[model samples]
Target: MKDTDESIELSKRMIQTGELCGKTTTAFITRMDHPIGNAVGNWLEVLECINVMKSGKGPKDLVNLCLVQAAQMLIQCGAVPSGTLKEGIIMARENLSNGKAYGKFREMVVSQGGDLRCIDKPEDYPRAQFKADVIATSKGFISDINALEIGHIGVMIGAGRNCSEDAIDATAGIWFHRKVGDRVEASDAIATVYTEREETLNSAADSVFQAFSFSEVPVEPEPLITNFVTKDGVSNFSMSIFED
Candidate 1:
């Protein structure tokens, strides 16, 4: 919501439309400077989410972002009292750990005619024929992993569509070992990319390597959630309750 004028206008219009129908509307505005979690493709991202839901363990940033969004949703929907945002977060974490979240996901997959065998045992899923590691050239702290560049690389590796007619490869995607602000030694595997096309492997790996920027000094990671937008106004921090 904070990115562009068009998005801001659209958000305001959405809230206004909801108001006309006597509904409440709000949005959690998060930064998109880098990929949310380690995985950035269809199957790889699903596996990451499954691991998080099943074990309540995954990337710290991804977990926190999900919890915060879930808490806000609970508050807005009145499933929990507006003032109990922290409680909502705790409840979400409990659901993740207690298998309820994974259960729901499994149910949804079955209902949608998706094959549960692959999700249940991800190892059985077909592997990418080609794989390459993006190694660090110098020892330093990672200052940036440009999200735009990474997204382009995703398309190049067939993880995403280049055009409306382009087909996606479920096994093609990237797994990051080191993200922003992580220290790396020379020749360390910062990330690994996978794809079915052997010819595209080297170019994709080179692009992924170029997407990373390094600094000799430590870099502060940017905040994931930057603002909260509602019918009332925008705020820098998320609020537990919004007075109507």
Candidate 2:
């Protein structure tokens, strides 16, 4: 289920009524507007995240956001204690800082019969061979990084599939060096686009470049976890009634 305030309340009520009790459920709540990093392809995204957990050279905001969201959900579901949530964040930060997360991810990749060597050097990974650099237009803090716009550009560049049978170019993606609240000059490089075809690369780069906007002031950071909800038996509050 999408991790919105309404959805979370609904899920809690269903569980309280013993309807969805004992049933395994998964919920995802991502920043619908701004996502982290630049890569969106299946294998490439894995590699990027792995690089993050290994080298600490990637976008910090994106990686940290994902870790915190995952930890919060785990704690809310009782899979892990609430106290451990902070620990999980700490551990994730440490693993990324120390390369432990990278090692663990590499192990998982190998266990799944995938080659770990490919991730050792991302430059060696297959590429579209075409590249374009996104240049900033003004001097200000990065206010937004639209995920949907980035995903759209990824699809256009062949990093994502438009149809079920369509193939995705694992190397055709983006690499972001700037994020929200980061100051940039008018000509600073914000991101780089990679694609197998020159034409696709050009079109994707144009689209992606237009996705970014700047302001004279810094943008306020959005809240990661909005609120928590639970069923109230005494007041007769339930998510089911809200649905009707």
Candidate 3:
């Protein structure tokens, strides 16, 4: 993407251009201002992914993201007709709902020499010894969640580490109970923290709470996917258009 802000006129030159369509089927997906879903730890993220693959229902944002991107890819490859992304999305959803995607995940795990027990049972992974809820103090709308700060809180609680050599607890992380745009009552459970260390739980939970910013105004979240690109063209995603 190019921007228009050149004040001083320099020598203009025509650089070589590359092909974007019909040569190879390529695409990219952009996550707009949010993490894929609310899970901030390894186990929680994997569980969400697994659930989506198996049942086609995890996080709405994530589900739409996967289907829309997959639709574009299918369009690029001539696997689906132009201007018929809904068909492609349905095909993608059927793959998940019918267990094709979930079966593929199992095959991948076995091929990678990872434990296959995690396929059906998330409990096979490392689990937190204890869990606690992060309660909301106000009755208001969830205006924003600082994802970067949440990542830091995860690291602080041993979910992640500062460096490659630093050990990470796979089970330590925060699972959000109230997502962005959700309404919260006073004392509502906004999030849940899972960790092995009891002494560090309060600090970690406190950090999670601080990461949330409440507002009086109700938030209508922007779509996770804004547009789709393929060999055909750029198609801006609109739920209203899709519905009609």
Candidate 4:
């Protein structure tokens, strides 16, 4: 869910709906000022997730967010003591680091008839015919990234479907090198756009470049997880909990 007033209210209503259906529900609202992780698209995202689950590492924001959500689930399921979010987070991280999480995912994939080849050897997956980089035009800190615009660019590049019947190019996607609050120099590769269709590569790259905004000074990004909503109530996440 979005970290907006309307979304907050909607989350409460959603929780109530889940209660009426006799289900436990927890809603986590986060900022969409930028895309969640570095890679954007179908296949690229799958690859990223596979890597994260296998190695217990990825972009900091992505890994941290996943661990937090997992911790919340553990709490709800009685896997950890109540109100001990930190302990739940530690348990989740241990499982991830020890390969148990990926093992379970593999087991489910095989039992459920998913393609074992994708998870076993993702390197065999094909790449797009065309790839181009979005270069930084000026030296500065990345102030903002318009995620909605980035999503539109993804659709334009064939990474996503415009209509239900439109075909999707699994290889088409964007891999961001620099995210918000990161510093960049002129001509640095900010992101790379890929597409099977050469015709859409340039246009997608241009749109990707325009989606990023720079600032002369360092910029602080919005918190990823803003509020947590449950049957009990809503509470803002303490920023201190995330501080190193």
| Steric clash pairs (candidate 3) | none
Best by lDDT: 4
Against the unseen true structure, what C-alpha lDDT does each candidate score? 0.86, 0.67, 0.74, 0.89
**lDDT tens digits by residue: candidate 1, 88-180:** 887777888899989999999999999999778988888898999999989999999999999999999999997899999999999999989
Q: Model 2 Cα displacement at 179 (Å)?
A: 1.3
- Runs in model 3 lying further than 4 Å from the true structure: 1-29, 81-83, 227-244
Compose the digit string of candidate 3's lDDT tens values, residues 1-244: 2111121111011111124322544344354354567687888888878878877678777777777777766765788755577888877778888888889889999899998888688767668998889999989998778777887888888898899999888888888888889999999999999988788899889988998889898998776555544444555557553454
Ranking by TM-score: 4, 1, 3, 2
Scored against the true structure, residue 133 in model 3 reaches a CA lDDT of 94
- The best candidate in terms of TM-score: 4
TM-score (C-alpha, index-matched) for candidate 3: 0.80
What is residue 95's positional error in candidate 2, in angstroms?
Answer: 4.2
Clash tally for model 3? 0
Clashing pairs in 2: 128-195, 128-196
TM-score of 4: 0.95
lDDT computed for candidate 2: 0.67
Q: Candidate 4's residue-wise lDDT over 41-151, tens digit each? A: 899999999999999889988988999999988988899965588888889999999999999999999999999898889998898889999999889999988999998
| TM values, all candidates | 0.91, 0.75, 0.80, 0.95
Runs with alpha carbons beyond 4 Å of true place in candidate 2: 1-28, 56-58, 69-83, 95-98, 227-244
- TM-score for candidate 1, residues paired by index: 0.91
Where is model 2 poorest over a 10-residue stretch in terms of lDDT?
Answer: 233-242
